[model samples]
Target: MKIPIAIVGCGGMGGRHLLGLKELASSDMNNITLSAVCDLRRDNAEHLADDAEELLGSRPLVFDDMKRMAEAMPDLQAVDITTDARAHHLVASTALDLGLHVLCEKPLALTIRGCNRILTAQKRSGKYLSVAENYRRDPMSRLTKALLDAGSIGRPELFMDISASSGNQIIITPWRHKKNMGGMLLDGGVHNADMMLYYLGDIDQVYARIALWEKTRYRPEGDGAVSGFYQRWFGEMPESIEATAEDTLTAVVNFNNGTMGQWTQSYAAHGRGFGHKVIYGSAGSLRPGGTRNGAPPVLAHDGQDEITGSPLLDLVPDFHLDAITSNLFGADRLASYDIPFPAADRKLLAIELYELAACVLNGTSPEVDGFVGRRAEALCYAAFESSVLNRPVSLDEIESEQVGSYEAEINEELKL
Candidate 1:
C-alpha cells in the first residue's frame, strides 16, 4: 500500500518535492504515491500535474486552492508545503487539522505567535508536523553529526559561523519585502540558526546587532526575475530600494552546555565567497566548507598531529536531471545511489520528503516537530529583542504558554 502524498505551492521548492517523490516511487523502496498537488496559480499546478502524470503514469489531482484539493483527495496521508513563510501557518495548520501529516518549509512562521499557533494546532490534532530544516540532514552535515557523536572534536567549546551573500538578487514577491512575512533573518537565517542549534545545544541567551544596507537596487513594482532574464522581460528599471529589514545581523549565543558561539549573516558582501561554519573544542576543531554551489569539504583538526586532516570520505555523486528522469521511469534501474545535493537547501528538501514518508508509514512525529520549529523561530525573535534592548535576552524571557513544557522536553533531550 503506497502512502498517498499531496504537495501544496507548486513553486521551485514544491517542484523539487514532486521530483523527489517521483524518484522514490520509481525506486519502489517504499510504496508511495503522488496523489495530488495544489498551487495558487492554475498554470503552475497544471504544469506540475503534467510532470507527475508523465513520471508516475498516474495523474495527480491538481487544484488552484489547497482546501479544494484536500477535500477532493480525502485519502491524502501527507502534504509537503513550500509556500512563503507568511502562509506557512495557515497551510500547515489546515493540513494538520485535517489529519494529514505536514512537512513545511523553514522559518515555520514569520512571528513567534504564528509559530505558536502552528504548535497549538499540532498538539490539538496530534498529527505529525515537521519543518523542512534540511541542512541538518545533508550528507556532510550527517558526517559532522557522526564525527561529533564520535568525539572528533572534544567537547565543542567555541563555535563560529559566517554567512555572507554578494547582495541577493531575489525576484521580489511582495511578501518577501514585507517584514510580517519574515524578512532576511526569518527567511534566510532560520536555516543558519537551526544548523547552529543542531551542532551546539539549545541557546541560553542571545545578543545581536542588525543593519540594513542602503545600496541594493530593485524595481518598485514588478514580479521578481524567473531565471537570469530579469531585465529582458520585466522592463522595470532597477532603483535603489530602501531595505526595511536587516541586511546584516551578527549575534552571540550562549548555549546551555556552556559553549560560547557567534554567528554572522550578511547579504551585502561582495567578491563571491560562500559562508562557512567552524566548530572548535579544547582538543581539535571541525570546519565545514561554505554554502557555495559546489562540493562541501568537511575537514577535521588533528590536535595530536597539530594539523588539519581531510579523511578520504567517499564523495556522493551528483545526479543530474537525466538521473532524476531515469530514477522515476526506470529505463536503466541503477541501484539506489545516495547522491548528495549541492548545498543545505536541496538536502533540506530531501529530509522533508523522508520525514513525510516516515510519518505516513510509521505514524511517528518527525524529529524536528512543530515545537522545535517554534523554538528556532523564538530564537530569531530573541535575537531581534536583544538587538532592540541592547542586552542579552535569556531563552526564559520569551514567554510562551507552552514554554514550561517545551523547556522540560528540551532539558530532558539534552540530559541537562
Candidate 2:
C-alpha cells in the first residue's frame, strides 16, 4: 500500500523529510509517494519539488498554502507537517478538517491549549496523527531502552542526562532568540523531554530554575561591512534581533514510580564541557566511558554474583537495530511486536517517518502518537512554570488549570 503524502514547510527540517520520503519511496519496502511539497516561500517549495522530481522521476506539486496543496492534490492521503512549532496546530487543524492524516514535528504546539486544538480536530476527523520525535528512535537510544527493559540495570533509581556545548548552542535560530517559537528549553528541549519520558516514565512533579546567561541579539557583524558567515543567524546577517527566551535551565523531576530524574541545559559553556547520561540502579551502574558510537555502554556492578551476566558479553556494540527489525518483520513475525522500519542505516528520522506512513497505510496507531507528544510538551512547559513559581508543580496542577502562565503568554503572543 502506497501512502501519497505532501510535505509542508521546506526549510531545514522539511527538507530532511523530503529526502527521507524520497528514500522511503525508492527503498525495497517502498510505501510512501511524495505528491507535493509546500513552503510559505515559493522558491523554497519549488526547489524541493525539483529535488523530488530528480530523485523520484516525477515532480511533486508546489504550493505556498497548505489548503491549496490539498485542493490541488485531492488524492493526497496525508501530510508531513514540518512547519514551525507555533504553526503546527493551525496547519494540522486545517489538514485534519480536510480529512488528511498528520505527522507533525515536535512539541506538537507551543501551548497545551494549542495542542488540544489539533487533538480535537483529529478526534473529529478520525484521521491518523503522530508526532515525529526521532531521538528515542535512534539505534543507541533503543539499545539502552532494551537493556533497561531486560533488567540489565536492575531497577533504575536515578538518571542524569546533561549536554554542555559552546557557541552555536544558545542562538539556535534568529526567531528562536526572538522567542516567537518557544525557547531553548521548549524548542530544543522537547527532544530531551521525550527521551526522559521514554526511560523514566511519567513525571509526577517538576521543580526548575531557569536563566538567561548570555543575552543575545541578532546583529550585523561581518567584515567591516558586516560580511561574515554567522552560524547563529542561520547564515543570515540580520540588522537587529531581540531576545525573550531562557537559554539555561536546571530541573529535577519526581516520577510517579518513585524514581528521580534531573536535566540541565547551558548554552554559555564556551570551552570545557561536562556531559553524560548515567543511570544508577540498585544492582548496577552504567556510564558512557567513551565518545565513539561503537563503544558499548559502560556497566559496573557492585560484585553481585547472583546477577551473573557479563556486561561485555551482554551489551555488544555491534548489534544494530536491523538485527531486531529483520527478526520482527521477516523471521519472527508473530513472536515479536517490533516494527521493521526499512532503513538499515538506522536513520532515526526515516524510521520515524516510515512509522507514520505505516500507520496511515495499515491503519494502526503510531508508536509516538499525538498524546505522547503532548505529554512530553506538557513536561517542558510545566518545567517553565516551576521555574517561575519556585516550586514543584504537580502534574495535577497542570491538568487542573486549563491555562498555565506559559500557555497564557503563548496564546496572547501568537494569538492562538
Candidate 3:
C-alpha cells in the first residue's frame, strides 16, 4: 500500500519536498501519497496543491494548521516537517501524537530541549521519526565517507571548512538572526556540523568563538522575493528589528579519533565567497567539496604533507576508489555501501521520503533519528556557550545540562 503523507510548511524547503514527492509519484514509485500540504499561508499551501495537481493529476488537501490537518487525514502515516526550525518541535510533536511518522528538517528544533520533547513524544507514540539531514545522505558526502574508509587519506589528522558568504542575508529567513533560531549556527550551520560528524564521527570536544562582526541592521522581510532562496519563505515581521544572535562563528572541533577540525561560518562575509571540506590525513589529504567548483568531488593528495601544495590525483568521481588499484587500496571498505550519483537537494528529500516509508513498512529505525539530530543541535549550542563563556566547552558538559544557552529565550519563543 502507498504511504499516506503530508508536507507541512510550504516554503523553500517544503517546496523542495513537494517536488521530491512529485518525482516519486510521477515515476510510479508509489512510495507516497501526497495527502496534504500545510503552511501558515493559505496561498503557499494552495500553490503546492496546484503543483501537485499538475504533476500527479490530483490535488492534496491544503491546511494552515497541522493539528487540524492531522485530524482531517487520520490515515496519514507520515508527515514531512519542513516548517521553520523554531516550530519543528510543535509540528512534529503534534504529528507524533497523531501516530504519524515524521521527517523533520535539520536541527530538529532551535534548542536541544525542544528536540528532546519531540524525541520523547516519538518514543511515547512508538512511531518512525527522522531528521532531514540531506547533507549526510548526499552523494558527495557518501563518496567522501567511502574514500575515508578506503584510506585514500589515511588516518584523518586535520579537517577544515570555511563557509564564507556574500549577500548571505538576502537568502536568510529573518528569524534566523534572532536568539530563538540560534542565529547562524542553528539556522544553517547545523548542516555543516552534521556533515563533520558524517565525516569524522562524533565530536569529542568543542572550543569555539562566535561573534556578530557586522551590525548591519536588516529589517524583517516584507513581501519576500519570489524567485530566490529567501523568496516566499521568510516570516513577516512588524518593522526595523535588530538581531541578537551571532552572525559569525569560528569553532575548533575535536573528534574522538584525536584529530582536530576547524570550522568557520559567516553570513555577513563578502568578497570572494569560499568554502570547501578538506581533511588532512596521515598518508594523504582529500577535498570533497570540489563539486561546487565543477571539479571532481573526490581528490586525493599527491604529496606527503597536507600543508604543502600537492596536486590531487585519481579523482575517483564515481567513488570507485578500489577499482583504481594502481593509486590506492580499500575501495572495498565502502563496498558494503552503495555510492549513488550526486543528486540535487530536492532529490535527496525525495530519497528521505522513501526511507521514511521504509521505516514503517520494514519496521526499522530512521537513519538520522531524533537523538542524532539533537546532538548536532547541542554542538551548535556548545559553540554558543564557548563563545559566551569565552572558553572551550565539552559536549558532555552541555549534554548533561551542566551548561546551556538561549534556553530561556527559546522556551519563550516556543512557549515551552
Candidate 4:
C-alpha cells in the first residue's frame, strides 16, 4: 500500500519539492502518493495542484489549511513541510497531532525550543520526523565520509568552511531578512552546521563575532538576474527593505574529538566573494564539492599525487550509494556527476521522500531525525549566543537552555 502524503506550503521550496516528487514518481523507489498540497494562500495551493495534475498525472486535493486537509482525508499518512523557518513548529506539530509522519525542511525550527516543540509533539504522537538535509545525502558527501573513515586524509586536525557574497541584494525573500523569521544566517547556516557535523563529530564550543553588516538590502530592479537555484523561485519583491538578520559571522568551532575549525560566512562582503569547505589533516587536505550536483571531491596527500575525479573513488573501495540512491541517481559508486542543479536537487528530495516512506512502511527511524536536526540547529544558536554574550558558548549550554539569550526574543515571539 502506498503511503498517502501531502506537500504543504506551496511557495518556492514547495515548488521544488513538487518537482522532486515528480522525479520520485518516475523512479523505482516511488512509494508515497502525493495526496494533497496545502498552503495559506489558496492561489499557491491551486497553482501547485495544477502542476501536480500535469506532472504526477493526478491532481492532489488542494487546501488552504492543513487541518481541513487532514479532516477531509483521514488516510493522509504524511506531510512534507516546506514552510518558512518560523512556521515549522506550528505546521509540524500540527501534522504530528493529526497522526501524520513529517519530513520538514532544514533548521527544523527557528529556535531550538521550537525544534523541541515539534519533537515533543512527535514523541507524544509516536510518528516519524525527518529533517530534509540534502547536503549530507549527496553522493559526494557520502564519498567524503567514506574517504575520511578510510583515513585518506589521516587524522582530521583542521577544517576551514568559508563563504562570502558581495552584495546587499534581498536574499531569497523578504522574510528571510527578518529576525522573527530566522534571518539569513539560521535560514541557510543550518546547512553549514549540518555539513560541519557531518564532516567533524559533535561540536563542543563556539566563539564568534556575528554582525549585521547590511542594514538595508535592495530588491533587484526590473528583471535583474538573481543567484543560483533561487532564480527558479523568484517572485514579486519590494524595492528596498530593512534588514534585521546578521549577515556576517566569523567563528571558531571546537569539536568534541579535539578537531578545530573556522566557520566564516558573510553576505555583506565587499570584495571578491570566495567560498570553500576544506579539511586539512596530518597527511593531506580535502576540498568538498557542493551538494546534489555530483561534484568530485578533491584530496591532496603528503608526498603522494593529488587524487580527484574518478580516481578519488579508489580511495574508498567499499564506498557506495545506498540501493535507493543508486537507482535514483543512476550511479552507485561514482566520485563525480554532471547532473544539473534543480535536477540533482530533485533526486535528493526523492531520496528523502523515499526514506520517509520506508520508515512508514518498515517501522524505522529517519537518518536525519528530529534530534539530529536539533543538534545542527543548536550549533547555529550556539554561535549566535556566543556572539551576543561576547564569550565562548558550549553546545551543551545552548542545548540545555542555560544560554539562549540570543533566541529568547524569537522564542517569546513564537510563544514556544
Candidate 5:
C-alpha cells in the first residue's frame, strides 16, 4: 500500500516537490501517493492536483486551507510543507500534532522562538519532523562531504562558503524580499549553514556583519516605496531603502569540534560564477566545481596535482522538473546531459520521500529528524545573531523553549 502524502503551499518550490514525488511514485523503491494538497490560493491547489494527475496518473484532493484539509484527511501519513518561512512553524506544528510526519522547508522558522515552538511540538507529539535542508543532498556538496568524512581533506581547519546569485530577478514574487518572510539570510543561507553543520558538526558561537547594497527600485507590481532589497529590486533607484534585514552577511563560527570557519552570503554582488564552498584542512582541501583561473577546486596534501577529478557532471541526477523534459521521459537522458541536473532541493525531496515511505511502512525513524533540523536551525540563528551583534554568540546563550501547548492547541483545532 502507498503511504499517502499531503502538501501545503503549491508555489514554485511546492510545485517542484510535487513533481519530484511524481517521479518517486513511478519507481518501485517505494509506493507513495500525493493524497492531498493545500495552498492559500484555491487555483494553485487545483493546479497542483491537475499537474499531479497529468504527470502521475492520480489526482489529489485540493484545498485552500491546510488545517481544514488535515481535519478531513486523517489518513494522510505525511505532509510536505513548502510555504514561506513565516508559515513553516505554524504548518509544521499543526501537521506533527495531527500525527502526520512533516517534511518542512528550510530555515525552519525566522525566529528562534518559533523554532523552539515547533521543537516542543515534535517532542510532545513524537511525530516525525524533518527540515528540507537540501543543499547537503547536492551531488557536488555531498561529494565534498564524503571527502571530508573520508579524511581526504584531513581535519578541516578553515571552511568558507561564498554564495552569491544574480539576484532574484527571476523571482518576481513579493514574499521572497520581505524581511518577515525570512529575506535572504534566512531564506537562502540557511541551506549553506545546514550543510556546514552536516560536515563540521555543532557550532558553539558565531559573529557576523550584514549590508544591503542597492537602496531603491521600482516595484515589479508598480507599487510605491518598499523597503530593503524589495525596494532596490522593485522600488525606485537612488532612494535609500532601510535594510531591516541583512542582505550581505559575513560570519566566523566556532564549532564544537574545535574547527573555525567563515561564511559569506551576499546578494549585493553581481557576478556569473558565485556559489562555491572550500574547506582547508591539514591534509587536503576540496572546493566544489573546479578552481577559479583554471586552478583545481580541490587541493590536497601532495599538492594540486593529487586532486581527483569531480564526478562527471552528466552523472549527476535531476530530481526536479527541467524546462525541457519530464522526469519520466528524462531518466535515460539524465546520463546524457552534461549540465549539473536538478537544483539541490529537488534531490533532497526525492531522497526524503523514499525515506519517508520506508519509515511509514516499516515504522522507523527518518535519516534526518527533528533534532537534526533544530541543530541546523540553531546554526543559522547563531549566524544571524553574530552578524547583528558583531560578536560571537554561543549556542548556550540562546534560550530553548517548547511548542507543546501551541501544537496541542493546533491539534485540537484539527480534532486530531
Candidate 6:
C-alpha cells in the first residue's frame, strides 16, 4: 500500500525533498505519495507545491498549518519534517500524537530534553519514528563500515574527522547561527557525530573546548548566490547579523570500543580550510568520502599506492549496497558513483523517505531510528558539556542530563 505522506517545512531542504520524492518515484522502491506540503509561510508552501507539480506531475495540497493539514487529510499516514532544528520536537511530538509515523530531520531536537519529549511521545503513540540521517546511507559510508568490519582496516586504532572552514558568511540561514535554534554545531555537527558513530562505535566520553570565534556574520551581497544544492539563497540579504552560537570546537573523543579520535570544526578559521575523515587501523588506513559529493574512499597500506575508485571495491569484495539503495542510485556492488549534486542529494533523501515508508509498511526499524539520532545529538551535547565543565564528560552523564551546564540555557528557553 502506498502511504499517504506530507512534507512539513517547505523551505530549501523541503524543495530538495520534493526532488527526492521524484527520484523515489522513479525507482522501484517508491511507496509514498506526496499528499500535502505544510509550512507557516504560505508563499513557501505554495512555491514548493508548484515545484512538486513540475517534478511529480501533480501538485500537493498546501497548508499554512500542520494541524489543519492533518485534520484535512485523515489518510495521512506519515510526515517528513524538514522544519528548522527547533521545530523538530514540536512537529514530531504532534505528528506522533496524531498516530502518524514521522521522519524528522537531524539533531532530532535542540536539546536532549527535547529529544526525550519526542521519544516519550513516540512511546505513548506507538508510531514509527525515523530520523532523517542521510549521511550513513552513502555508498562510501556503507563500504567503509564493511571494510572496517571485515578486518580490511584491522583493529581500527584511530579515526579522525577534522573539518575547518574559514568564513564569516551566513551558513545557509540566519537562524542556524542562533544557539536556541541548534546553531552550527548541532545543525551541522550532527552529521559528523552520526558519521563517527557509524564508522567507529558508541562514544564513551569527550573532552572539548568550544568557542564562538566569529560573532558577526555577513549575508551574500547579490542575488544568485548559492549556499547548498542549487541556488538556495537569492536576492538581497541583511548586511550583518550577530551570532550567538559557538562556531569552533576541538574535542578528543574516546569510543566505547577502545578507539579514540579528535573532532575539530570551526567556521572562524580565516586563512585556510581543510577537511578529512580518515581512520587508521593496525594494518592500514582508509579515508572515506563526503556525504553528497559521491567521491570514493582512499585506502592506503605501508608501501601500497592508495586504492580508490573501482579498485577500492576489491578491498571489500563482500561489501554491497542493499537492493533498494542499489537500485535507487543505479549501483549495487560498486565502490563509488559519479552521480552529480542535486541527484546525489535527492537519492540519499529518497533512501531516508523510503526507509520511513518501509518501516510503516513492513514493521521494521529504520537504519537511523530515534535512539540512534538521539545518541548522535547527545555526543554533540557531550562536547558542549565538557567545554562548560572544563573536563571530560561521559555520554551517560550527558544523556542522563547529569552534566548539562551548556544546554541549561537552551533547555530553559525551550522549557522541554
What does the lDDT read for residue 416 in candidate 6? 70
Tell me the tens digit of each residue's lDDT in model 6 across 161-182.
8888858988767788999998
The lDDT values for all models are: 0.65, 0.71, 0.72, 0.88, 0.64, 0.87
Model 2: lowest-lDDT 10 consecutive positions: 328-337
Colliding pairs, model 1? 134-348, 171-224
Q: Which ten residues in a row have the lowest lDDT in candidate 4?
A: 223-232
Model 3 root mean square deviation, Cα atoms:
5.7
- Clashes per prediction? 2, 2, 0, 0, 12, 0
TM-score of 4: 0.97
In model 5, which runs have C-alpha deviations exceeding 4 angstroms? Answer: 165-172, 217-244, 271-273, 289-299, 310-340, 343-345, 399-416
How close to the true structure is residue 155 of candidate 1, measured as C-alpha lDDT?
90
* lDDT comparison, 3 vs 6, better candidate: 6
Q: Which candidate gets the maximum lDDT versus the true structure?
A: 4
Give me the runs in candidate 6 sitting further than 4 Å from their true place. 228-233
Better of 3 and 5 by TM-score: 3
Predicted candidate 1, C-alpha RMSD: 7.6
Clashing pairs in 2: 222-226, 222-227
Scored by Cα lDDT, where does model 2 land?
Answer: 0.71
| Regions of candidate 2 where Cα sits further than 4 Å from its true position | 167-172, 217-235, 288-295, 303-346, 399-403
